[model samples]
Target chain A: MQADQSALQCNACGGLCYFSPERSALECLSCGECYDLGQPDDYLARDEFAHRPDVAEPEDNITPAQRTHQCQNCGGEVLFTGPALSAHCPYCNGPVVLVSGDAGYRTMALIPFRVDAAFAKRLAQKWAASRVACPAGLADVVAQGDVAGLYAPFWTFDSDEVVQYWANFVKPGGKAIRISSTKGQMKIAFDDMLMPASPHVTPLIRDGILHDFDPRDLKPYRAGYLAGFAAERHHQTVAEGIAANSADKDLLIRNHIKYKIDRTGVHGIRYLTDTSGIHYRRILLPVWILHYSYGGHAYKIAVSGIDGRTFGERPFARRRLALYSAAISACVIALGMAIGAAAAF
Target chain B: MLAETSPLFAAAALFGLSTYFGLIPIHKLIQMHEARHELRQGSASRLRRAGGWVVVALWLLTVMWCAVFIGDWWASGDYQAASERAWQRIGILAKLAASAGGVR
Candidate 1:
């Protein structure tokens, strides 16, 4: 299939342009011109493929592993390799956005990067410096590493669930404890339960920035959003994403039941859930990943590109911790001796 | 002198044992809390079980130490002296408690 490709260009100088987070617009690097990305088209909005049987199946026009697009501005060829639907033109540094022929599920919407690269790096460094019981100068080591902005693919689901539960409880009686059984049903509606579809995002990273993006801020997917940033294709299928989402929903239902049964001395909980009206959309969320080494150990730090929240692995100062333990032990021993002497008297 | 000092030495030894059995698990809990992000399910569960066992062991050790001390005093026919010392300690504790209560 032939994919339509175009590079955002500056009106004044006709130079290549890229999306600038600070300006929230497509800015030309040559002329420093900022172009407003006008209102997004409703046709490109989310849920276009919702409730469709062929949502997971590849379309007849799906692109192959390797394809080249002629740059509109420089007439140079831009090569997109291995699930990359967009890239910068190597010859002219133009931002190229492929309009169609995306492999797998197409991205419906995205929460664009609000935090720039420099700000993300600062946030990571600050997080490293604030860690307790870590080696000194750790932040300096982390500061030396470059922060890469990535658009990580995720699946957001909306569903309605009916949970029917049977529970037993104990009540105090005059002469004995009384056991009673109660049955009830609960209806729950979940909106935008997000599941990461990218392998690059670890569980810790997902947890740290799980609630960082505001759903209301999600914009219709535009190829210009891929400008000046790397975006990942969704690696997991809809069925796999649905499985993960169901696990989380089950936990939520259990907690809801427990809350409903609180103060009833509840035990022996058994429940069955009926889920329906499941709707999902594929989208991209922004993340900044930084890799750094401290004392021969490599660690990764992830900062939420939406809110700048940071979470990462840190190196512990074992020698300093051992010294602290020895000091604590001596103090405990001295306290023990004093108490023993007092008791003896 | 031996009779008076023996209880103190025993008490100190019990405290030493408590420290040995107690601090290591407590430290493990602290480490778990600090490195919670990196901890896997299997290792975290093992650490929690270790902590629970330490608590149970400490309680049993306390009860056993009291039982051994009282049994030794009873077997040696030193009950009179031990009882007198217990009453004196109780009185001192009561007085300290009263003072603390007044301060509060």
Candidate 2:
């Protein structure tokens, strides 16, 4: 026996309602009724030590991308890979919300899909056609691929970093001249440093999915937003995601310091950095993802649900590459021969 | 003396120096452009591409300037003469500075 899974039902006609990206409202599929979600409250909780009772801490040793969900409609086993949110049961086609987390993992905040499925499909077609090495038949191949709209789990960190740095600037001429050493302190404040909280999602994929997202677009978590779309719950703790990006953040801070002080000749620089007043919030961002096979190889492309920004690995035409390489090599060899002849003379 | 006057050697040195100092930023710009391109942010990608080209053009111009300087030295055969003139000018400027400062 599985817990009852419920979806948004239209009050007018008893039809299923889905969150429409274009309308930014819920639309009934049967009666074509539109319901506005109105404004979502901006509630950002900032207690680093606070823990939600419903949220379970990740295991000390962690490895799991699969979750089992028993569909309430048909009692069929629904296998969810990664942090996927919503799917239809194969047995009954009933919409099933695969909650991978405990009650604590309920909706916190989300960036709803601004680009709808139709727009996503059109963008996919346009992107495939514009690809440089795309086969002539790639359009047909892409047309058959399934595109799923889902919200990926992310941890947005806000903090202020203060760094104490020391650097030795060499004299204009050389070390033989008087050397000047300087020490200074710098403070950098950043908000919404969003990192993918799902272990399977990388920064690259997240950027591909939500290019230049405005944090203002984040809405208070509502079950209605997850009505039509699949949502993934965060697997990695906020600390873990921050730890994953700590080295890069350090490098960024160092570069920023260098940019400020390394104007002339910098001999060496050393710095110590501390991030304070750290706060974080969990949110889900929309992405349109498709994995398709072409020429016996699989390819994946993701489009930002907020914007139409697309990113993916595109295949190159081997035949065209070989021809270009041959031509370039021939020209290079001829040029070398002509240069050698002139040198001999 | 020949190496000093040859534009090729000077150009090579300029290229090396420019490359050593500029390659990292150029690589970063190109990477930024590519990342923007991947995300289909056409305007942003174009901006990055233009910035990357500006850096390349600046490096090229620096190398060209060095080559032109070397060419002038070789063509005029006045490398030593130019150095002597520069030293004389510096001496005159220093004397003027001393006089203005009432330092005899």
Candidate 3:
């Protein structure tokens, strides 16, 4: 059952962005700016996208899990081959039939998976080991679903720009702390800033599971990729991506510019501008996403197919936690005795 | 002979204190397991989902803040400054810790 759903509502401009894989951009249906797929040059917080599929297309001739169907919901393309599986369409950030698509999914620049399920399990176990306040049935939480592995499409952007920024410098003006008016500038060149272009890209909780794509790793879109599994389309757009990236590039350039200015001991700056160029590539990275609900919380964990980098939360073990806490406490008390003995010295 | 072991003792004492106080949170988390089991039968609530993250984030960042500042206090030579800052830190910690008891 395909449903129409979208999560992006631009608070700045009462607008909605649809991910267009054709251009690998988040096109603001309202505005024409293409937000490239992929993360900006310096992103700190993990982001999550609700992948939607083409549920708005009223023609229901395409069978579920049998053909690559356009969603009636978000108008994104996807492979819907199984009844038991559903995924976010990357183009519209909605649920879609994820089977196989032939409508032109260009499989190029693939990064093969380096991390395997064993590592994913290990990393997940380790991560669960850390979330102590996590529920007691941690093992069950990790066991809740079949982890799906797929190569998600990403659009990478590179750019050069002339950026100007204003910053404050804390200077030692006669020992009394004085904040100085600081202006700075720099030339920033961005390379390989990745954005998710595939409709229904994986969320941020997945980490370290990227594969190094080689030419040999690419495979054309085949229905078999969805025969036993599900597939998703990208919902993020190049326009939204570029806007975010542009802001980021501007900030980074300003930071470097500020550093350059600060190093010169000049507390003030001038009409700072950046001269920069941009380049990009389309890539498909390997990821294994396990989505399940436990304790009423929807938990999604990503395991890197390359470096075993993991992200997300799950239930915690009560008995194990108790034992650990007691052990740690006992160890601390024992050490406290040593401190007492030393204080005598 | 004991002087050689003094540092170890001091480290252990602090570790124990930290561990013990932290047990309150650990216990609460474990107790939360029963609630999760009960929740299985009911529909998942987005409120609870959001609350879980909110609580976790708050506690995590605060603990990190405490650990960093407290570590700084121990590591720095200015014990007076550290001690004074410790009071300021504890004041902030107390406000946060107090807020922890009353989450939906």
Chain B TM-score, one value per candidate, order as shown: 0.34, 0.44, 0.49
In the predicted model 1, the residue pairs found to clash are: none
- Shift in Å, residue A271, candidate 2: 3.9
* Candidate 3 lDDT tens digits, A171-263: 542523445675545566655555556435532321123333233344333332222233443344444445544543443454456456543
Docking outcome class, model 2: incorrect
TM-score per candidate, chains pooled: 0.64, 0.61, 0.46
Residue runs of model 3 more than 4 Å from their true location after superposition: A1-107, A112-123, A130-137, A173-175, A198-229, A234-240, A244-276, A314-345, B1-104
Q: How do the residues A154-269 of candidate 1 rate in per-residue lDDT, one tens digit apiece?
A: 87777778989988766543434467788899988877766667544555566665445556777886666667776666645667777755554565566567677763456677
DockQ for each candidate? 0.07, 0.05, 0.07
In lDDT terms, which candidate is top?
1
What's model 2's lDDT at B100? 32
- Give the per-residue lDDT of model 2 (tens digit) for A1-345: 021123367789977777888988878878989988656345342222333324675533232323445457654443342223446543234466554523224335777788988788778877777765356777678778778776777777777888899886544443233457888999988666666675445556665556587777778766567666655555556566677777546655656675667544444679987767676777778877765777787676777888878776556555544444344333433343343233223
| Cα deviation of B5, candidate 2, in Å | 34
Q: Model 3: DockQ against the native?
A: 0.07
Candidate 1 per-residue C-alpha lDDT over B1-104 given as tens digits, one digit per residue, 9 for 90 to 100 = 43555554655555555545544544454455544543232222222333343333343434343434443444444645654654554544444333332110
- Count of backbone clashes for each model? 0, 3, 91
lDDT values for all models = 0.61, 0.58, 0.46
Q: Which candidate model has the greater TM-score, 1 or 3?
A: 1
Question: Candidate 3, residue B32: CA error in Å?
Answer: 24
Q: What tens-digit string does per-residue lDDT give for candidate 2 at B1-104? A: 54454544644555455445554444444345556466423222323333444444444334333444444444455666533443444444434332332110
